[model samples]
Every structure is written in C-alpha cells, then in structure tokens.
Target: MSATRDLHDLGQSLWLDNITRDMLGDGTLAAHISDRDVTGLTSNPTIFEHAVAAGDAYDGSIRASVEAGKDGEGAFFDLALEDITRAADLFRPIHDKTDGVDGFVSLEVSPQLVRDTAATLAQAKELHARGDRPNLFIKIPGTPEGLPAIEEAIFAGIPVNVTLLFDAKQYLAAADAYLRGIERRVEAGLNPQVASVASIFISRWDVAVKDSAPEGYKNRLGIAVVQQAYVAYLELVASARVQRLLNEGARPQRALWASTGTKDPEASDTLYIEAFASPLTVNTMPEKTLIAFADHGKVGEPLARDGGDSEQVLAAFEAAGIGVDALAERLQQEGADAFQKSWDSLLEQIATKSQALTA
Candidate 1:
C-alpha cells in the first residue's frame, strides 16, 4: 500500500495545500485525489498569487471577468470560485460518503478584512455563497478580530477552516468560536452540524527560531508545539462541552496541521508530515511535501494523546530563551501580514493578467 494510503488509513486526512487552474486543467488535482489520497485541499492568497502570476492558464478566465466589468477582488474571486468549486465537485463523492467529515476544499477570506469583523463576515458570506459548494470551506484567520467573524460565519451555516493559528491557545480560541456558533444554532433551532477545522501552523515555529535555537533543538520546536496542541485537541474533543454539542448533532471541529512543508532544506522533507501524524486531525501538504511524503513517507507511531515529552521539550526551548506564548502572537500577526501582502500581490497579478488578456 502507498504510504499516503497508510497515513489516510491511520485516520489522518492528507490534504493538498496548493491549487491552480493548471492543476485542474491538467487533471493533476484529480490525480492527486485518486493516486495520492489527497482527500481535501486548502488555498490561500499566496497560492492564488502564484497561480495567477505564473502562467497564462488563468488568462482566458481573467479576460472573461475583465470583459464582464469585474476587477480586483471581484475578478479574483470569480477566478478562484471556478477553480475551487470544480475541485469541490471532485471531492464531493468522499464528502457525501463520509457525511461531511472529509472532502473539503478551502478558500480564505480577504486578508485585508481580517481585522474588520463586519467586513470579514460580509466577504466570508459572499465568498461562501459564490462557491456554492457544500464541501467548500471559507477560510478565516484565527486572529482576535477574526474570532467573532468565525463564530458568526459558522452560526450562519458556513463551514470554516480557521487559518494562521500558531499555538494550542490559538487553536482553542478558534474552537471556542466554532463552539459558540454551534451553541447558538442549537438555541435557534438550526442544524448544529456545521463542519470546521482549526488549522495550527507548524514549521513556522522552527523557522522563526532557526537562528536562535541550539543545534540539538534545530528542527524539533515545531513538532513539539504541535504535539502540545494535539494534547489540547484531545481534551477539547472529549470535553463535556463538546459532548453536549455532539448530543445536539454537532461534529467536533478537527485539528489541522498547516505549513507542513519543511522550510529547512537540510531537514527531512517529510519532517512535519511524519511527526504530526495523529488520528482525527489533518496534515495539509504542499505539492512538494506531498510528493516527497508519497515517495517515502513513513507513518511513525502516532502522536501520543498525552503529548509525550511535549511540555518538557517546550521547557527546554523556554530555558533557551524562547518565549513561546509571546512568539505565538508574533507569528500569528506575521502570518496575517504575510497573507495581506500576498493578497495585494494577487490583486496586482490579476490586474496585470486582465490587462494583458484584454489588450
């Protein structure tokens, strides 16, 4: 059996972290689903920026949107929706078979609106409606400003993939937002089965501390942090609070490992994927990482529910002067900034491509 299948059979979903029109046109996305066990996908500003800028694959669509008098975010979403909804259809079978537990494709809300709760909600609802696919998740950042929007979006029956979470605390905050949304639904006599995932970013921890960390700690911090979060995830899923919701027909918001692509080239390409392997969670891999893992990814023993040595490992980093809690905030902020930058770039790319396609 393929190691990718092994990972999936072990109960962790393998989701592709990249999407482009070419991937769809070339049948690569569908092939990834069938051959690599990539049951889901997640896209971001960076991914779209790269996709639109890299080639003429999107040029025809850009021309159509431009001709329709769409520009900037409107044109961009038109392009994004076409790609995502098609990808969503590809996964719909799995989505139906699993009863909404898997087979999701995510599109992030405008990063520029992350801090504006009202704007974020408006854009989120708009984009979700635009996609119009039951398996499509409108991604919202897990920033403080994003929390209320996350809750409101879920309460409105929009599935969310909460992005940019850096630590267990951030993950829990996103979960709370999801819980509140479900709770409100139950009280209002709505279905409480809105699906969601709290995407905790890995690898960024190590990237952030790479220069400061001792050699012995070089690539270990990210795994340790995610391990700690996994412990919290176990507790959260088993908590009576969530159980009460389950009784009300709510599905527990799952934990997802983002940024699983290794930044440090010297480290094993599959470092995060192999280490963060735990049942009932997800690991969204970049195409490179997914290909690498499929080639030789070993399913190591799954992460211990108690987070074996996670606290101790984190303590060692603390002793080394890494203030994790503070760093988590910084990383989250940095992530939002980075997404905004990517969003700006995506708009510019779309504008450039539109002009070129029209001219």
Candidate 2:
C-alpha cells in the first residue's frame, strides 16, 4: 500500500494543501480522493495566486468576469469561488459519508481583512453564504483581532479553519474561540456541532529557528511544537467544559498541522509528515509533499499523547535564549502579513490576466 494509504489507515487525514482549476478539470483531485485516500483540501490566496498566474485555464473565465465589469478582488473571488465550489462538490461524498468530519474544502477570507475583526466576520459570513457548501470552511487567522471574528463566525454557524497559529497558546486561543461560539449556539438553543479546525503551522517554526538553534535541535522544533499542541488538544477534548459542550451536541474543534512540507534541503522530505501523525488531527501538505509521501513515505508510530520530551526540548531552546512565546506572536503576525502580500499580488495577477485576456 502507498504511504498515503498508510497514513489514512492510521487515521490521520491527508488533505491536499492546494487546489487549482486544472486539478479540478483534469480529475487530479478526484483521483487523489479515490486512489490515494485524500479526503480533504485547503487553499489560500498564495495557492490561488499561483494557479491563476500560471496558466491559460482561467483565461476564458477571467474574460467573462472582466466583461461583466468585475475587477480586482471582486473578480478574483468569483474565479476562486468557482474553483472551490467545484472542488467542494467533488469531495461532497466523503463529506456525507463522514458526517462532515472529513472532505472539507477551505476558502480564506481576504488576508487584507486580517486586522479588522468586524470586516473579517462580515466577509466570512458572506463567503460562507456564497460558497453554500456544507463542507466548506472559511479560513481566518488566529490573531487577536481574528479571534473574535472566529468566535462570531462560528456562532453564526460558519465552519472555520483557524490559520497561522504557531504554538500551543495560539492553538488554545483558537480553540477557545471555537468553544465560545459553540457555547453561544448552545445557549441560543441551536445545534452546537458547527465544525472548525485550528491550523498550527509546523515547518515554519523549524525554518524560523534553524540558524539560531544547535545542530541537534535543527528541524526538531516543529515536531516538538506539534507534540505539545496535541497534548493540549487531548486535554481540551477531555476537559469538563468541552465534554459538557460535546454532550450538548457540539464537536471538539480539531487541531490541524499546516506547513508540513520540509523546508530544509538536508532534512528528510517526509520529516514533518512522519513526525506529526495522530488520529483525529490533520496534516495539510503541499502537492509535492503529498506526492512524495504517497510514493515513498513511511508511517511512524503516532505522536505521544503526553508530549514526550517536548518540554525538555523547549527548555533547551529557552536556555539557549529562544523565547518561544514571543516568537509565536511574531510568527503569527508575519504570517498574516505574508498572506496579505500574497492576496494583494493575487488581485494584481487577476487584474492583469483578466485585462490581457479581454484584450
């Protein structure tokens, strides 16, 4: 069996961290679902930016939308929604079979709204309503401003993928937002099982600390962070508060591992994927990483629930003058900014392409 199948059998979801019109039209996404056990997908402005910039696949659609007077971000979302909606339909079956636990496709709100809680929440509602797919998740950052937006979005019954979280604290914040939203739903006498995932980016941590850390600690921070977050995740699920919510018809918000692709050339290609395997969690991998794992990846023992040695390793970093708490905040902020840049570039790309196609 392929290692992708192995990971699936081990109960960790394998979601492609990408989507494109070509993948949708060429049946590549469907094949991944049918043959490789890929059950879900995630997209961001960067992914869509690359997709729209790289091909003629979007030319006709761009022309049509441009002819209809849609331009800039407006034109971009229309094109993106078309692709995401189609991808959502392709995954709809697994969504139905899994009762909405699997087969989710995520669409991020404009990264430009990352700092405005009200606008973020408003856009999330609009996008969720526009997508109109049961398995769709609105992607929001776990920034301070985004926390309230996440809570509001979830309370409004929108499934959210909380992005750009870098540590246990960020994950907890996102989880708390999810719980608050669900609790509000319970209070309002609505069903509280609105789905959500807190996406903790993995490899970026290692990349951030690579030059600062000792040789032994190289490429290890991301896995240790994941282990620590998993411990928190287990505690959350078993907590009285969450258990009560679960009894009230709510589901525990899942912890997702993002940025799982290896960033260092010297590192094992499957380092993040092999290290972060756990049931009920997700590892959203890039297409290259996904194909590599399916081709030659090995499934290792699952992560220790108690976060074995994570504290000790983190202590070493602390002793070495690495302040993880401060770093997490910085990383999350930088991530949000990076996405904003990508989103702006994406809009520009769409504008350029649409105009050229029309011409």
Candidate 3:
C-alpha cells in the first residue's frame, strides 16, 4: 500500500495544500485524489496568484470576467469560486462517504481584511454562499479580530477553517468561538452540525529560532509547539463541554497541522509529516511534500495525547531566553502580514492579467 494510504489508515486525513486551474484541467488533481489518498485541499490568494501568473491557463476565464464588467475582488472571486467549486465537487463523494468528517477544500478570506471583524465575517459569508459547497470551508484567520467572526460564521452554519494560529492558546480561543456558535445554534433550535478546523502552523517556529537555538535543539521547537497544542486538542475533544455539543449533534472542530513542510534542509524531508501523525486531525501537505511522503515515508507511533516531553522541551526553550507565548504572538502577526502582502500583490496581478487578457 502507498504510504499515503498508510497514513490515511493511521486515521489521519491527508489534504493537499495547493491548487490551480491547470491541475484541475489536467488529471493531476484526480490522480492525487485516487493514488495519493488526498481527500481535500487548500488555496489562498497567493496560490491563485501563482497559478494565474504562472501561465495563460486562466486567461480565457479572466478575459470573460473582465469583459463582463467584473473587476478587483469580485472578478478575482469569480475565478476562485469556479476553480474551488469544481475541486469541491470532486471531493463531494468522499465528503458524503465520510459523513462530512473528511474531504474538505479550504479557500481563505481576504488577508487584507484580517483586522476588520465585520468585513471579514461579511466576506466569509459571501464566499461561502458563492462556493455553495457544503465541504468548502471559508478560511478566516484566528487572530483577535477574527475570533468574533469565527463564532458568528459558525452560528450562521458556515464551515470555517480557522487559519494562522501559532499556539495552544490561540487554537483554544478559536475553539471557544466555534463552541459558542454551536451552542447558540442548539439553543436557537437549529442544526448544530457545523464543521470546522483550527489550523496550527508548524515548522515556522523552528525557522524563527534556527539561528538562536542550540545545535542539539535545531528542529525541535516546532514539533514541541504542535505537541503542546495537541495535548490541548485531546483535552478539548474529551472535555465535558465538547461532549455536550456531541450530544447536540455537533461535530468537534478538528486540529489541522499547516505549514508543515520542512524549512531546514538539514532536517528530514518528512520531518513535520512524521511528527504530526495523529488520528482525528489533519496534515495538509504541499504538493511536493505530499509526493515525497508517499514515496518514502513511514508512519510509526502517533503524537502523544498527553504531549510527552513537550513541557520539558518548551522549558528548555524558555531557559534559553525564548519566551514562547511572546514568540507565538509575534509569529502570528508576522504570518498575517506576509499573507496581507501576498494578497495585495495578487490583486495587482489580477488587475494586470485582466487588462492584458481583455486587451
């Protein structure tokens, strides 16, 4: 059996972290789904920008949208909705078969609106309606401003993929917002089966401290952070609070490992993949990383529910003068800034493409 299948059988959902029109048009995406056990995928403005800028694959659609008098976000979302809805259809079977536990496609909201709670929620609802796919998750950042939006989105029965969380506290805050939404639904006599996932970024932590950490602890911080969050995840899923929601027909929001590709060349190619093998969660891999893991990856024991040695590992970092809580906040802000930059660039690219294609 393929290692991807092995990982799937290990009870973790393996999701593709990239998407493009070319992949959808060709058999590449279909192949990944069939042969690589990729039940889901994710996309963002940056990925879309890369796909559009890489070639003329989207020229025809871009021209059509441009000619139709659509511009900027509307035009861009038109293209994104087309691509993502098609991808979502391909996974619809897996989604239904799993009873909605797997086979999800994520499309991120405008990173430019990260600090605007009302706008974020509005756009999230708009995108969710535009996609019109049950398994299509509208990704909202798990920032302070986004927490309220996350809750409101959930209460509205919109599935969310809470993105850019860096630590257990952030994850739990997002989780609480999700819980509040579901609890509100139950109280309002609505279906409480809203699906969601809190995506925690890994590998970036190690990169953040690569130059400052001890040689022996070169690639351990990221995994330690994930371990710490996983402990909280296990606790949340087992808590009486979540149990009460389950009784109300609500699905527990899953914890997803994002930014998992190894940044350190000296680290194992499958470093994050191997360390993050846990059931009831997800690991969204970049295209190459997914292929690499399928080629020669091994799935051993899963992550510790109690977060074995995480406290000790984090203590070591603390002693080294690395304040993890502060670092997590800084990393999250940095990540948001990076995504915003990408969003700005992508909008410019879209406008340029629109003009060029139509002209």
TM-score of every candidate:
0.98, 0.98, 0.98
RMSD of each: 0.9, 1.0, 0.9
lDDT (10s digit) by residue, model 1, range 274-335: 99888999999999999999999899899888888888878988998889999999999999
Segments of candidate 3 deviating more than 4 angstroms: none
Lowest lDDT 10-residue stretch of candidate 2: 350-359
Query: Taking the tens digit of each residue's C-alpha lDDT, what string does model 3 give over 1-359?
Result: 88899889989999999999889988899999999999999887768878877988877777888889988877788888899999999999999999999999999998989999999999999999988999999999999999999999999999999999999999999999999999999999999999999999998899999998865788899999999999999999999999998998889999999999888888789999999999999999899899999999999889998898889888888999999999999999999998888888878887998877766
lDDT of 2 by residue, 1-359 (tens): 88888888888899999998989988899988888789999999889888988878888788878888889878888888999999999999999999989989999999988889999999999999999999999999999999999999999999999999999998998999999999999999998989999999998888899899865888888888889999999999999999999888888899999999999999989899999889989999998999888888899889999999899889889989999899898899888888888888988888788767867
Cα lDDT computed for each candidate against the true fold:
0.93, 0.91, 0.92
Q: What local lDDT does model 3 show for residue 209? A: 98
- Candidate 1 — what's its lDDT? 0.93
The count of residue-pair clashes in candidate 3 stands at: 0
Using lDDT, give the best candidate's number.
1
Clash pairs, candidate 1, are none
